[model samples]
Target: MFTLKTATSFEETIKKSLFICHATPITSAEEALAFFQTYHQADATHNCWAFKLTQSYRFNDDGEPGGTAGRPILQAIEGQELVNVAVLVIRYFGGIKLGTGGLVRAYGGTAAKCLHQAEKEKIIPTTLIRCTATFSEMAMVKSRLWQEGVQLISEDFTENGVCWILSIPDEQLDVLSAVYTNITRGRIFEKIET
Candidate 1:
């Protein structure tokens, strides 16, 4: 529902190997995969990645193990209640083999650290509608909706009157429609919720 406005990174040492985690918010899994491929290095020993968007999710251990690397990283992301985000943990082997537990710590810890440092934002559900009003009723009609918490997206003046496009919270749809009618004495325009 929400996405980060910027990318962030973090680093850590695990069993002598340097694990660097790069995280960014993305609206879909396709974007996340594209970002991972773009930043994935041929020289890094492993580039494990994970992403969660609502009920959909995916993770890649990248040959590390069955579930040690990517799954734990996903857990870290979910633990923080993040959505529409991806975290790629790149590990540079320092001549040490980190067992399953160590790999989990390396990848999961790096993701947690990176996401913790990144900026987070909340998503609000909204409905977009076009409310038309007569030229004479424009101002009052618009004013009433604004006072009722409807966000005005834009307005247009035409031969018929002034048409206002606005976004209101989904829950307020019926109320907004009813109030607009009463406020304009049935002169306001129709509404299309999107």
Candidate 2:
């Protein structure tokens, strides 16, 4: 799956009506709703939107024809193979009436264009690992983690050692565990966070 690297936007005029599309990366329905609240234009004629998450998806036409605006935007996101994203298309009627087809083209095309223009990154699944190591082993563990491209989430000093929370690529857990064992000579203990 892919996701937007950053927020992006595009605007265009169709049949004298203004269409503005804003695309943002979102991980949950709450974030999607927050995006809508942040970007919805109160003065616009419509605030159509669509979102795609791993487990859920939704769209709203916002007074446009039943399937004209939001569904097309969702289709655009699917066409790009995007997940964890939300797109809002705001329209300002300019006294010109665009038929359903025109509305679809305007909203969907604008959203697609905006998304195409924005940067995208692959979604790498990750697993959290907790490691406890003696203070003397800290330097080596930190170096190994850096070499393996593991992200250190938090570090806590304990009476016996330091506890580190790390995010590792899910596919690399076994290899990393073996490497850690080797580095610490089986002194450091590691476990995957459930």
Candidate 3:
């Protein structure tokens, strides 16, 4: 439930050539690769890139060297604990030379700094559920649920009292179930989410 709010791009000069790194949070591997392809300048001397999604990803030096460019950048991404993200580092040679190892450190270091500058946000998931309880138990249930941040989305009054629709966090289900039992003396029923 964590993700970056925006894509960030940064530019730096390493050994004369300008290095531009674009870092964006992506949900899938395909999206990551597509981003690299879309933004890469074909005429550039090198367009090295790295991406990671969950536990799987790949990086390519794009002819820089065996491990001097891509692998290090990918490591930097993982080291930052970033997920669903891609880093495309485009290098335009300035007719100067940085050894293969220098290129790796430059690409990865620049990308890591870009990500460090980006903002991160948390996304809390909510689920819909049906809850039923007797009339006498309504007050207690309502109070406890409100305290727990459960939203009473809607309700249907019936002979048995009220059937309510609510939104709750997944992690709070067990505690919420206990609250329902204490309120309705086990008369309450909550439908499990599929």
Residue 159 error for model 1, in Å?
2.5
Please, what are the lDDT tens digits per residue for candidate 2 over residues 47-99? Answer: 99999998889999999999999999999999999999999999999998889
Q: Is candidate 2 or candidate 3 better by TM-score?
A: 2
C-alpha positional error of residue 8 in candidate 3 after TM-score superposition, expressed in Å: 0.9
Q: Alpha carbon lDDT of residue 53, candidate 3?
A: 76
Residue 78, candidate 2: alpha-carbon lDDT? 96
User: Model 3, 147: alpha-carbon shift in Å?
Assistant: 6.9
What are the RMSD figures for all models against the true structure?
A: 2.9, 2.7, 4.3
Off by over 4 Å in 2: 135-137, 181-194
Ten residues in sequence with the least summed lDDT for candidate 3: 185-194
For all predicted structures, in order, the TM-scores are 0.82, 0.83, 0.70
Model 2 clash count equals 0
Q: Which sections of candidate 3 miss by over 4 Å?
A: 122-173, 180-194
